[model samples]
Target chain A: MVDLTHTLSPEFPFLPVEGKTFPFRSSPIATIKGDGVYANRWELTEHVGTHLDAPCHFAEGAMAIEAIPLETLFVPLAVVSIAERVATNPDTTLGAGDLMRWEKDHGEIPARAAVFLHTGWDVRTKEPGAFVNMDGAKTMRFPGFSDKAIEFLLGRRSISGIGIDTLSIDPGRDKEYAVHKELFRAGKWAVECVANLSRVPATGAFVFVAPVKVAGASGAPARIVAVW
Target chain B: MVDLTHTLSPEFPFLPVEGKTFPFRSSPIATIKGDGVYANRWELTEHVGTHLDAPCHFAEGAMAIEAIPLETLFVPLAVVSIAERVATNPDTTLGAGDLMRWEKDHGEIPARAAVFLHTGWDVRTKEPGAFVNMDGAKTMRFPGFSDKAIEFLLGRRSISGIGIDTLSIDPGRDKEYAVHKELFRAGKWAVECVANLSRVPATGAFVFVAPVKVAGASGAPARIVAVW
Candidate 1:
C-alpha cells in the first residue's frame, strides 16, 4: 500500500487562479486542555493540494464532485515515467509518442485505467518556490501530459482518468489549459499533485481516488491509495 | 464496491459540540459562465458529515489526521447489523453480548477490521429534525455502540476501529462520551454518520477509510469504501 496525497496545510503551495489566492487553512476549534476533545475548522479551495478534479471543473453541465460514480473511483493504475527527460528539461510534456512506446513495451493500456505521468516533480514538493517554478515572464515550468497524449488515452485506451505529479495535468507553461478541457469534456476526472508514483509499478496496481464527498463542488482534496 | 460516505453540504446534520456549531459551506469562486473553469471555496468543521475521528481527537498525543498510518486505513470490514433492534428502540445500543454472538456464528472477529453497527439511521437523512432528534432538554437520541462493546473489541480483537450509522460511535444520549474515550485511549479511530452500511456483508469485504490528509488536524471527513 502507498499514499499518493500531500498533507494539506497553509504552507503547501497553492495555484493562484486569475490573480486570486485561496489557501488551505486550519485552526483548532476544540482542545483537550480547553474543551476535553480536539477538532479543527478548515477552509480551502476545492482544487488545492492532491485533489481530484470532477468533470464539472471544465466541462459545462457535467457531474459535480458529489455526483461522480463510485464504480469509477477504483481503477487500474498505469504509470508512465518522464523523469529522465524532465531532469534535463522541466518544460517537457509526455507526448503521444511516449504513450505509444509504453503500449509497445507493456502490451496495451488496460480499460478503466488511470494513466499517471510520473514526472518526478514531487521531488520539489518540500521547496515551495521550486515546486512552482516560474520563469522571468511569471510563467510556471513543469512536466505534464501533452493534450495529444490525453486525447489518445481518452479515445483509444478507454481510460477512467489521468493523473500527474505536478500542479496541473497541462504543462505549466500552458496558458490555455487545453488538456483539462479535453479530459473534462469527455466526463473523465483527474488528479493533480500526485506523490510517490515511483513506488508503484507500471501496471498491476489498482488505486482508489477517494475524494471527500463535497456537494456540488468542482473538486476536493483526495486521499488516493494504491494496492496490489 | 460500496461508498460508505455521505455527501457533505450545509444542510447535513452536524453534531453540536459544547454549544458550538460549525456548518459546512461551499460557494462558487469561479464559474464556467464567467471564468471559463469552475471551482469553489469550501469551509467545514473537521467532524462534520461522514467523518473519521483520529486517535488525537481524544488521546492528547496520538497521531493526527495526516500522520495516521496507511496500513491501518485498508481494513477488513465486519458489518454487524443492529437495524432490527434500532427499528423499535431509537436509542438502542449495540452491546458486548452482540459481539460474542457475532463471533459464535461467524468465528472470531478478524484482526485489523472495522466493525460497523448498521442502525438503519440513514433513512432519516433527508429530515434534519428527526435525524438529530433533540428533546425538550436538548438531548439527542440515536443508536451507537456500548462502551463495553468497544472495550471488548479493543482487548480481544486487534481491531482498527468501530463505526456507527448514527451521529456518533457513542450513544446520542451519552453526555460523557465514554465509548469515545475508551476507543481513542487504545489508539483506535471511529467513523460517524456512515452511509450505506446495510449494503455491505457480515464479513469478507475490505474497506479503505481514506480521510483527507489535513495537516496536524485532529480528524477529517473520510470517503470510506468497501470492495469484495
Candidate 2:
C-alpha cells in the first residue's frame, strides 16, 4: 500500500481562491509534562492538502461529499503517467489519446475504475509558488485532464472518478473548467492534490479514497491510498 | 461495505476540552447561481467527530498522524459487542473477559487486527447531552476499554490498534486515561467516535481507518469504513 495523500500543513499550497487560504492552526490541548495526554486542536479548510471534490462542487443538486457511495470510494486504479509531456510544457493537458495509449499498453480501463493522471507534480510541494505555477498574468499553469478525456471516461468508459497529482482535475488556467463540468454532470467525483502516484502500478492497484463525511458540505479533505 | 463514521456537522457532539469546542463553520466560496462552481471552506478541529488517535497523542516523540504506517491503517476487524452491559452501567469498561467471550464465539483475535469495542453508544448522537453524558459533578459517562483488556490485546494478541464507538477509548470520567497511555506506549493507535458498528460483522470484515494525515499533529479527523 502506498499513501497517495500529502501531509496537510500550513506550508501546503492551496488553489488560489480569491478570499480564501488554507488556515491550519494547531495548539496543544494536553501535554505530556503537565497532563498525561498529548493532543491538539486543528482548524483548516476542508479542501486543504489532498482532498476529494464531490459532484456538488461543480454541479448544483449533485451528491455532497458524505453522500458519495462507499462502493465508489474503493475501486481499481488506472494510473496514466504524463510526466514526460508535462516536463516540457507545464500547461499540457491530457486528452483522450493519452487514455487510449495507456489502454493499448494495458487492457481496457475497467468500469468504475479510479483513473489517476500522474504528472510528477508532487515533487514541487516544498516550493509553494512553483507548485501553484502562476504566471505574470496571474494565470496558474499545471497539467490536468482535457474535456475530451473526461468526456470519454464518463460517457464511454464509465469510470468511477479521476484523480491527479496537481491541484485540480482541470487545467490550472482554465476559467471555464469544462472538464469539471463534464465529469460532474455524470455524478462523478474527483481526488485532487494526490501524492506518491509514481509508486503505484498503472493497473491492478486498489485505491481507497476516504473523505471526511461532512454532512451537506460540497467537498472535504480525504486520505487516499492505493494497494496492489 | 459499512460506513462506521459519524456525519460531521456543527450539531455533532464533540469531546469537552477545557475552553475548547469543535467549531465547524462552512461558507460557500462559489455558488452555482453566480459562479459556475459550488464549493465551501470548512474550519474544524482534527479530533472532531470520528477520528484516529496517533501514538503522539499520548506518548512524546511518538509517531504523528502522517507518520502512522499505512500497513497498520488497514486490517482485519475484530468487534466485541457490549451493548447490553453498557446499557446497565454507562461507565462500563470492556475487560479481558469480554474479549475472551468474543474469541470463544469466533476464533482467536488475529495479530495486526483492528479490535473494535461496540457499545452501541452511537444511538445517542442526536441527543447531545446524553451523548456526552455529563453529570452534575461534570464527569462524562461512557463505555471504554479497561487497562487489562488493552494490555491483553497489545501483549498477547499483538493487535495493530483498537477502536470504539464511544467518544474515547478510555472511560470519559477517567482522568488518568490509562487505556490511551498503555496503548500509545506500545505504539498502537486508536479510532474514536465511530458510528454504525451494528452493520459491521464481528469477524471477517476488513476495516479501513483513514485519517486526514495532518503533519506533526497528534491526531486527525478520519473516515473509517468496514467491508465484509
Candidate 3:
C-alpha cells in the first residue's frame, strides 16, 4: 500500500478563497494537556488536505460522503505518470488528447478504477511558493483536467473517481469549476491534494479513499491510499 | 469495498479537549459559495475523526506515520461484533478472556489481519450525554480494549492493527492509556473512531488504514476502508 495523503500540518498549503478570508489559518491545531494525556485541537475546512469531493460538494441533491457506495471508494487503480509533462510546463492543462496518449502508453482504465493522474506536483510541496504557485496574478495556476479531458474520462470511460496531486482537480485559474461540476454531477468522486502517486504502479493497484462522514456537510478531508 | 468512516457534522461527537477551544465547532470552515465547494483553509490536529496511531503516538523513538511500512496498513481484516455485550453495559471493558470467547464463536484472529472490535458504540454519536458518558466520578465510561486484551492480541496473534468503532481504543475512564503505550511499543498500529463496521463481515475482508505522512507526529486521522 502506498499512502497518498499529505501531512496535515500548518505548513501544508491551502487553496485561496477568492473573496472572504479563510476561516482558519493553515496551521496545526494546538495540543491541550488533558488531566493526564494531551489531546490535539485545531481549525480546518472539510475540503482541505487530502480530501474527497462528494456529489453534493458541487451539485445539489447529489450523494454526500455517507451516501457514496462503499464499493466505489475502493477499486482497481491506475496511476498514469504525467510528471514529465507537468515538469516541462508547470501550468500545463490536461485535455482528452493527453489522456489518450497516456492510455496508449498504459492500458485502458478498467471500469470503476481510480484513474490517478500522477503529475509529480507534490515535490513542490517542500517549497512553499512552488506548491501554492502564488507568483503573478491573484489566481494560482497548476496542471488540472481540462473540460474535454473530464468529459472523456467520466462520460466515455467507466471510472469511480479521479485522484490528483495538485490542490484541486481543476486549474487554479478556473473560475467556473466546470470540470468539478461535471464530475460530481456524474455521480463520480475526486481525491484532491494526494501525495506520492509517483510511488504507485501504473496499473493493477486498488485505490482506497475514505472520507469522514460529516452529516449533511458538503465535503471533508480524507486519507487516500493505494494497495496492490 | 466499504467506507467505514462517520460523517463529521455538528451532530457527530468529538473527543472533548480540556483547553484551547478555538476549533472543533460544528462547522469550522465556510462553504465555498456558488461553487458547492466547502472549506479552503486547513485546520485541526493530526489526530481527528477517523484516524490511525503510529507507534510514536505513545512510545518514544518509535515509528512515525510515514516511517511505518505499507504492508502493515493494508492487511486482511476480521471484525468481531460485541454489540450485544455493549448494549448491556456501555462501560464493559473487553479483556483477554472476552477476546478468547469471541474467537471461539467466530474463527481465530487470522495472522497479519487487523482485528476490528465492533461494539456498536457509534449509535450514541448524536447524543452528547451518551456519547461522552460524563455522568459520575469516572467522567466517562464506554466500551474499550483492556490492558489484558492488548497484551494477548499483540503477544499471541500475528496482527497488524486494532480498530474500534468507539472514540478511543482505551475506555474513557482509563488514566494510564496502557493499551496505546503497549501496542505501539510492541510495533502495532491502531485505528480509532471507525464507523459502519456492521456493514462488513467478520472474515475475508481487508482493512485499509492509511495515516497522513506527518513527518514526526505521533498519530494522524485516517480514512479507513474495508474490502472483501
Quick one: best TM-score, which candidate?
Answer: 1
Q: Chain B TM-score per candidate, please.
A: 0.97, 0.97, 0.89
Model 2 C-alpha lDDT per residue in residues B71-128, reported as the tens digit of each score:
9989999989999989899998998999898999998997789999999999999888
Q: Which ten residues in a row have the lowest lDDT in candidate 1 chain B?
A: B14-23
Instruction: Identify the CAPRI category of the predicted complex in candidate 2.
Output: medium
Segments of candidate 2 deviating more than 4 angstroms: none
Per-residue error for B101 in candidate 3, Å, reads 3.5
- Top-lDDT structure, candidate number: 1
User: What TM-score does each of the candidates earn?
Assistant: 0.98, 0.97, 0.86
lDDT of 2 at B29: 70
lDDT of each: 0.88, 0.88, 0.75
TM-score of 1: 0.98
User: lDDT tens digits, residues B1-228, model 1?
Assistant: 888898889999888766555678888888899989898888888888898999899888988888878888898989998899998998889889999998898888899988988999987777888888888899998989987898789888899887887888888899888998888888888988899988998988998899999888888899989889
Write the number of the candidate with greater TM-score, choosing between 1 and 3: 1
What DockQ does predicted model 1 obtain?
A: 0.85
DockQ pick, better of 2 and 3: 2
Q: TM-score of A-chain in each prediction?
A: 0.97, 0.96, 0.91
